[model samples]
Target: MKRNNFHTHVFRCGHAVGDEERMVQAAIENGLVELGFSCHIPMPRYRRHLLKGTIEERSINNIPSFIRKLILGGPNMRMPYSQRHIHLKEVQRVKEKYKDEIQIFQGFEAEYFEDYQDYYQELLDSNTVEYLILGHHFDRSSINERYYGRAILEDKDVLKYASQVVQALETNLYSYVCHPDLFMIGKRTWSPACQEATTQICKKAKELSIPLELNSGGIRRGLREIEGVVNYPYPYDEFWKIASEIGNDVVLGIDAHFPNNFKEENYQNLELFAKRFSLHVIENFTFRKGKSNK
Candidate 1:
């Protein structure tokens, strides 16, 4: 239970309280030795609909230009300002501030959707990024273009999207696959066919030495229905059964969007579930600083 937490989020990616110092303080208070800050990389462009969703929100009202530029990508969509020197400065500041207390690493949760392989490779090759994690919330490559909200709308594109996930994992570039169980909530129900597909993916993950995430964040703050009902990300029994059958590696990600979101109470239920299945805890993983030990 006492170990490092490597998948913390930061404020730049729409988090309300993911400031560097605040994150470090939270880790220290939690007695974590190795804390990693993995902010979401700015998407090539925020989807247009997202602009309508939060443009009038009070907190981001002051920096409307910044947020708009983020969506528009302005003149630098390919190499935007989000990937500029500011990230380096912030990482350096955090490292210097918490030198001995915690080993802070610079990382980004990159979206490995379609047409992003080169850009992601550039980021990985830039040498500034210490880790690369996958956040495949909405399949960017799916031909159907259905977002998480419409996951239950079955289509052949679903298979293509799932295969794309396998292809991305084939690259062996991700530190961890973020939220693999994310959209299972909206599935019609646990089906043998779905379980078979998941088993196949897990088999590949195991072969490629990639760790599939057990994301607490998905369970904690799930997508809401038009009727205001909250949907859990995955059924615990289904996940355990599939994982046990596949025998793939697993890692715990708090997927914390807000500060103090990974506290004992927040993670307790999932932790208990993981313990019951004997899933691997990623905190004990020892990499070569940057390169994965696998």
Candidate 2:
């Protein structure tokens, strides 16, 4: 079986630790055959569009997001657009420097933003990015109350998450779905809406053959009591059970925000997640190449 992790991040994405070459060195140390640098993508006009979101209506929810964005000069959430070229240049240099040691890929863990549709296509068309995975972190906008990970008391937001994800998968742009169970972050237990959301996503991904990721980032949060159940914030047991029954193709994503995240324990946990859910996890998928020519 090929050892590869299609999710990773570096200092450019304010929230994570380490740099490009440091991350590459970590992957090589961990024996990763392929390491994908999927830092949060920079939107061309971020603050402009972010202001266009419903942030004003939800002033309180916008504070923390802005804290990182403002204090970090907006590098807190994602790399600023101006830094894109420099970031890619350093990544290209590291990629060339260690080509023989390990395979490195430049990818982005992106959200589905209709405003940036043309930009996403341009990145792919120009070969600026090798592939993209739908992280499904927010609603139409990124930094507002619409963020799916913002609140997780019930299925209301998750249902919306399902709707947006379905639309994204239909575009045939993303290579895989990351953390398909992200919306279950704080839910106490399963519900009908959870079933509806999971089923909707699994059916579409199965039809499109886009593998669903069993991400380990959520595993770092450790287990918690969901009513009587104990499990990670995501890669939720109930969610994966539904996925297992549906027989959707599954893949493991390290969601490596830190360099040390490329270790053996994380991989073991991912496999343990599959075993716990009876998931037939696959190790590879067709890396997407821009929009479908058809």
Candidate 3:
């Protein structure tokens, strides 16, 4: 299969390293045919959203960021809204500069926030990005207690992840689902409840003809024993097992936070995971059109 990655991120997102040009250059050096920048989508009036909730909404480790949000209201979880324009402009410049070497795309890895639904549509309608991928990191709101990765530990939240993922897919705004098993990062036990939740996401993606991404970001954490089975936090074995049974299309996402994340090791691990579960991993995706296309 031709090498490509559509889940790339950069320093503007506040949790990543490297810049757009550096990542694009890295992709070219790695012999990738295509590279898509999918940094976290910046929200309008992000500071207001931060202020709407109390500090209790933030996790203990994120206290320093909470303080940053309170005063500076600059990039933390996502790029500050003010930085969005500059990020887009820079990507355009790099895409043009690297056009002869590789295909570069602009995209955002977005969560399903009800308040920003219209804004998301606007982004698509205006051709602000080439595509969007559903990376449902948080629940309800971006800075909430119901984080899918860190806070979820029970069936209710995992089920919520499934329900909301289905809802995000129904909108037809996302090209693919990034880390459908992100809930597994928090709830590791492969219990009946976990199976049920995974089943929901797999079945719906199969129905929508949307591809589920086996994210390499989780693999960066390395293997650990979850219920005595050593594995990466996501591309979670049991989750992909259900997805395999459902015969859903799967894609490999580097989920690149740094330029080096595009290295062959991550892709190899993603392939190994796919082979382990007999996942039908596809190499390309369809970019869903926004409401404005109507």
Candidate 4:
């Protein structure tokens, strides 16, 4: 089977470690056939600053407060317009250097905010980014919107998240949905509401023929144990079970934030999880460049 990981990050994403060259070398050494860099796209400066303040204020008594702060306040976490050009240049150079060894792709893990729709379009129009993966970290691009980590898994929140996923798929901008079950990050239990939300997401993905990613980053972070049950929010077995039932196209994303994360064991774990859930894992999905933005 072909080995590929489309969801990856680099030092540009502030919170992640390593550089693009280091990540590429690691992928080749780890026996991967293809590796795509989907670093976080920069949000507006004002929005980022506001989010940083909010995270700092609420981080006072939070467990993993340092991580939360890093995620929220890390400088250059997202690639601004000027920075993206440099990032793309570096990726192109690396791709040329390793062209014979392994395939390298340039892309971004972007948020689907209607307000920032034009920004994504501009990126696509520039013809520098090869693809975009929708990873909804927030309901909206605005600072006022609730972050997924802080979001309550109420019926309304679930519906809102699912609806956003549907809208994102409709845009046809994303190559796949990264961490489709990410809303379950802070969620303790797999409620009926969670199942319903995932069902809706799976149905839409199946209909659109867009692959949904089973991210391995959650596993690396450790599982959330609730009521004596251990589970990862993104790879939440219940979610993938529903996805399998719906017959949605699935892919394994390492979501590699560090160089060493692209390992054989991680791949084996992802494949094992897919098998347990009865998901049809696609190993060699083609990524075409200069595809229409709309």
| C-alpha TM-score for every candidate | 0.77, 0.94, 0.94, 0.86
- Which of candidates 3 and 4 reaches a greater lDDT? 3
lDDT of each: 0.61, 0.83, 0.85, 0.78
lDDT for each residue of candidate 4 in 141-175, tens digit (9 for 90 to 100): 32323566554556678778889989888888888
TM-score-better candidate, 1 vs 4: 4
Among residues 3 or more apart in sequence or in different chains, the pairs in candidate 3 whose N, CA or C atoms overlap within 3 Å are none
Which stretches of candidate 1 lie above 4 Å from their native place?
43-80, 141-146, 149-158, 222-231, 285-294
Specify the poorest-scoring 10-residue window by lDDT in model 1.
Answer: 285-294
lDDT ranking from best to worst?
3, 2, 4, 1
lDDT of 3 by residue, 147-205 (tens): 78874478888888889999998888888999998888788777787888888888889
Weakest ten-residue segment in model 3 by summed lDDT: 52-61
Query: Over 4 Å off in model 3, which ranges?
Result: 55-61, 292-294
Of the pair 3 and 4, which is ahead by TM-score? Answer: 3
Candidate 2 lowest-lDDT run of ten: 54-63
lDDT of 1 by residue, 190-239 (tens): 55556665776677777777777777776675544434443465524565
List of clashing residue pairs for candidate 1: none
Model 4 segments more than 4 A misplaced? 44-77, 80-82, 142-145, 286-294
Clashes of 3: 0
TM-score of 1: 0.77
Stronger candidate by lDDT (2 vs 3): 3
Evaluate model 1: give its lDDT: 0.61
Give the alpha carbon lDDT tens digit for every residue of 29-81 in model 2.
98898888888998877776677674544553656767656444456778877
